[model samples]
Target: MAKSGNKMATLLNLILVLSLVLMISIAESRKLGEEAVACDSVYGAEEGDTCESVIQKFQLGADFFLSINPNLNCDNFFVGQWLCTEGTVN
Candidate 1:
């Protein structure tokens, strides 16, 4: 009986932790979406567009770009990916 109770408690704890993580993830994603929507200026990635190229084209600092596009995976960036070129996300 004690062992069963322990297992149940562990399972409940896992569920609670997972729920909190999921809630946090959803909130973060919503925040990022809001920031993207609030962007005053936007840019689309082109075939040969690198992060450096985009930064140079838009005259943005690397840190600023990262700050505005928190979800951007520069290493895995693809064509047609929209970026916030100017925004209040800073």
Candidate 2:
């Protein structure tokens, strides 16, 4: 009986953690952009791609690249994500 009770408690804790993660993910996605924005120029981040490397590849500066992508972190994006290379109206 104690073993079963421990399992139930563990399951409940797991559910609560998953729910909090899901809620935070939803909020963050909305913050990033609710809808996709059209891109004049775009870059698909490949493995080991960094802000400096990308800007160098495109012949742009760090400030320019970061400026075009507001609310974005230079080193916090996932691989294979597409980013706008040019600034677009929201």
Candidate 3:
């Protein structure tokens, strides 16, 4: 009887720890979703707009814009170029 009781107690403790971890994960997921913002540009790139200018107007630090748009040629951005301004890359 004593051995059975000890086993039950250990199982309950394990369950409690698992529940706590699950709850923490759920809360963190919610927080991350709330913090995430959509990455869409309102205005298209105008004629003669450079990648550096776009980065500056969007408040992105140097290299951040290029990092977001890997296909984009930083030094050869044409007017009317569109790009994503937010969201996870992968």
Which number leads on lDDT?
A: 1
Error of 3 at 57 (Å): 0.4
Off by over 4 Å in 1: 1-37
What tens digits encode model 3's per-residue C-alpha lDDT throughout 1-90? 999999999999999999999999998767453333345554577877777777777787656566567676767766667765654444
For all candidates in order, the CA lDDT equals 0.85, 0.78, 0.70
Name the candidate that leads on TM-score.
1
Ranking, TM-score, top scorer first: 1, 2, 3
Q: Which window of ten consecutive residues has the lowest lDDT sum in model 3? A: 33-42
Write down the TM-score for model 2.
0.50
Model 1, 48-85: lDDT tens digits are: 88888899999999998888888888888888899889
Higher-scoring candidate on lDDT, 1 or 2: 1
Instruction: Give me the overall lDDT of model 2.
Output: 0.78
lDDT assessment of candidate 1: 0.85
lDDT of 3 at 20: 100
How does candidate 1 fare on TM-score?
Answer: 0.57
How many residue pairs in model 2 have overlapping backbones? 0
